[model samples]
Target: MTLNILSRQNTVLNKFIAQIRDREIQRDPMRFRRNMERIGEIAAYEISKTLRYTPRIVETPLGQAEVAQIDDSIVLATILRAGLPFHQGFLNYFDDAQNAFVSAYRKSTKDGKFKVKVEYISCGDLEGKTLLLVDPMLATGSSLVLAYEALCERGGTPAHTHVASVIASEQGIDYVTNHMPHQTTTIWAAAVDEELTSRCYIVPGIGDAGDLAYGEKI
Candidate 1:
C-alpha cells in the first residue's frame, strides 16, 4: 500500500491541520469541525487526481468542446459521527458520488485493551467501484479495518479503496498497511504522528475528534 502524507509539503492544508491540533482553537467546536471539513476537501481534491478519466465532448454556447471527465464509479464511505463533517467536505467536491456509512467504535475489553465493534452499516452495491473510506483520526486502525470488512460484507468488495484520515499514528499506518488489501489500498493523511498512548490515542494528536467536533460522550 502506498502512503501519501500531504503535510510533507507546505500548503494551506497545514494551516487547517495546525488549527485542529491547537488546544485553544479546539475550544471552538464550530471551527474545529470546519477545519476537519477543510482538510477533507483538500484530501478529496488530491485523491481526485488518481481517479480514471475519459474524454467527453460538450457543447458550449459558441461551439463544441472536449474535456477529460472522471469515468470511475466512486463510493464515499465514512465511519459515523466523527466522519460526518469530513464526509461532507468530500461530498462538496464529488457531488454525485454514492455514499456509505458504517457505525464502528472501540469497545473496552479486559485490561486496557479494546476491540472494534461494528454495530451498523448502510450501503448500496459497491462492486467494482472506487471506495473512499474517510475517518478523521486513525489511532489504532482496527476500527477502520473492521469497518472496511463490514462494508465489503454487505456491499461487496470495491475495486480499490482509498483510506483517508486527517491524522494518523505510525502504528496505525503500519497496521493498515499490513491488514488492508495491499495492492488496491492507498493511505492518505494530513499529518502523521509517531506516538500512541496506552489507551490508543495518538500523541500530540487532536484529542477525541468526535468529542471536539461535537461534544464529549458519557
Candidate 2:
C-alpha cells in the first residue's frame, strides 16, 4: 500500500485540522462536523488527481469544449457514525458515485482488550469499482481493516481501494499497510501522530470523532 501524508506541506488543510483538534472548538457540534466535511472534500479533491480520466466533448451554449472526465466508477464507503461527515465531503464531489456504510466498533473482551466487530453493512456490488473507504480517525486500524474485509465479502472485489483518514497514528498506518492488499490500495491522511494510548486512541487526536460530532453515548 502507498501512503500520502498531506500535512508534510503547509496548506489551508492544517487550519481545518487545528479547529477540529481544539478543545474549545469541539463545543460546537456544527463547526466540528463542518470541519470534518471540509477536510473530506479537500481529501476527495486530492485523491481525484490519482484517478483515471478520459477526454470528453461537452456542448456549450456557444461551442463544444473538451473536458477530462473521471472514468472510474467510484463507491464511497465509510465506517458508520464518525466517518459520516468525512464521507459527505467525498460525496459532495463524487455526487454520482455509489455509497456504502460499515458499522464496526470495538467490543471489549474479558481481559480489557478489544476486538473490532463489523456488524452492519449497506452497499451495492463493488466488483471492478473504485472504493474509497473513509474514516475520520485511524487509531488502531483494526476497525478499518475489518470494515474493508466485510465490504469486499459482500460486494465483491473493487478495482482499486483508497483508504482515507483525517488523522492517524504511526501504529495504525503500519497496521493497515501490512494488512490491506498492498498492490491495489492507497492510504491518505491529513496528519500522522506518533502515539496511541494503551486503549488504542490516537494521542493528540481530535478525541472521539463520533462523540464530538454527535453527542456522548450512554
Candidate 3:
C-alpha cells in the first residue's frame, strides 16, 4: 500500500505533533483545537506544493512578475464537529476554494454490530476539481470511505481526492487504500498507530477529536 505518513522528520509538522501529544497541552481545549488547526495549515501547504501550478503574472510595487499559482480549483470537505477546525485551517490557505461538509454517524445494530449512516452532505459540483476530505481520526475507515461515496453520489465525481487526518491506524489506512480509488486518491496522516480498540479508536490517538475540540456532546 502506498500510504503517506508524515511525522516529526518534517519539523513544522513536528511542532504540531508535540503540542497534540503533550498531555498538558491536550487538556486545554482551545489550545488543542488550535494545534489541530496548525497541523492542518502545515498539511495544506505541503499538499499544495504537490498540486499542479502554472505561471501567472502578478503586479508588484515596481513591476509585474510571473509566479506559480495553483491551477485547479479545490473543494474542501470535512466531517462535521471534529473536522471544523482542520477544515478551517485548509480554508485559511484556500480562501477562494469551494467548501463542503459531510455528517456521518455510527449506528449500532440489534446484534451489537455497527454501520455508518451518512445523513448529511453539503457540497458543490466536484467535477474536474480537486477534493480534500478531512477527518481527524481514521480508525475503522468506514466513515471516511462512506463520506467520499456520499459526496460523489450527491455531486459529480472529483478528478482527484485527498484524504487528510491527524492520526490513523494501520488497519484503517489499509482499509482506505484497498477500498478507495488508489490511482486518483491519496491518504495523508501525521502518524499511524498499530492497533485499534474494539470500540474503533486508534491506539495512542489524540482521543476523540470531536470531543477534544468541541467539548462532549450529550
Candidate 4:
C-alpha cells in the first residue's frame, strides 16, 4: 500500500496537529473538534490530487470556459462517532460523493485482549467506486481492516480504497500494510508516532478522539 504522511513537509497543517496534541488546547472540545475538521479538510484536498479528472467545457455569461472535472465516483465511509467530523471535512469538498457509515468498536475478551466488532454498516453499492475510509485514530488497525472487510461484504468491493487517519502508530501502519490490498489501497496520515501502549493507544497521540470531540463515555 502507498503511504502518504502529510507532516513530512512543513505546512500550516502542523499547527493544527500540534494543537490537537496539546493538553491545554484539548480542554476546549469545540476547538478540538474544529481542529480535527480542519485536518480532515486538508487531507481531503491532498487526496483529491490522486483522483482522476477529465476536461469539460462550461458556459459563462461572457463566453465559454473549459475546466477539469473529477470523473471518479467517490464513496466516503467512516467509523462512527469520532469519524463524524472528519467525514464532514471530506464531505465539505466531495459534497456529491456517496456516504457510508460503520459502527465498530473494540470488544474486550476473557483473555484481556480485544477483538474488533462491527455491529452495523450502512452503505450503498460500492462496486467500481473509490472508497475513502476516514478514521481519526489508527492505533492497532484492527478496527480499520475489519471495517473495510465488513464494508466490502455488504456493499461490494470498491475499485480503489483510501484510508485516512489523523494519527497512526508505526505498528498500526504495518498491520494495515499486511492486511489491506497492497496494490489497490493507499494510506494517508497527518502524523505518525513510533509507539503504542499495551492497550493499543498511540504514544503522544491525541487521547480518545471520540471523547475529546464529544464527551467522556461511562
For model 4, state the Cα shift of residue 186 in Å.
0.6
| CA-only RMSD, every prediction | 0.8, 0.7, 1.3, 0.7
Full-model lDDT, candidate 2: 0.95
Model 1: colliding residue pairs: none
After superposition, the stretches of candidate 4 with alpha carbons farther than 4 Å from their true spots are: none
Instruction: Candidate 2: give the clashing pairs.
Output: none
> 178 in model 2: Cα distance from truth in Å?
0.7
Across 1-218, the per-residue lDDT of candidate 1 in tens digits comes to 89999999989999999999999999999999899999999999999999999999999999999999999899999999999989999999999999999998788977878888899999999999999999999998999999999999999999999999999999999999999999999999999999998998999999999999899999
Candidate 3 ranges beyond 4 A from true positions: none
Put down candidate 4 lDDT per residue, 119-138, tens digits, no spaces: 99999999999999999999
- For model 1, state the Cα shift of residue 83 in Å: 0.8
* Cα deviation of 131, candidate 2, in Å: 0.4
- After TM-score superposition, what is the CA distance of residue 96 in candidate 3 from its true location, in Å? 1.1
User: What digit string (tens of lDDT, one per residue) describes model 3 on residues 150-194?
Assistant: 999888899999899889898888889988998899888988889
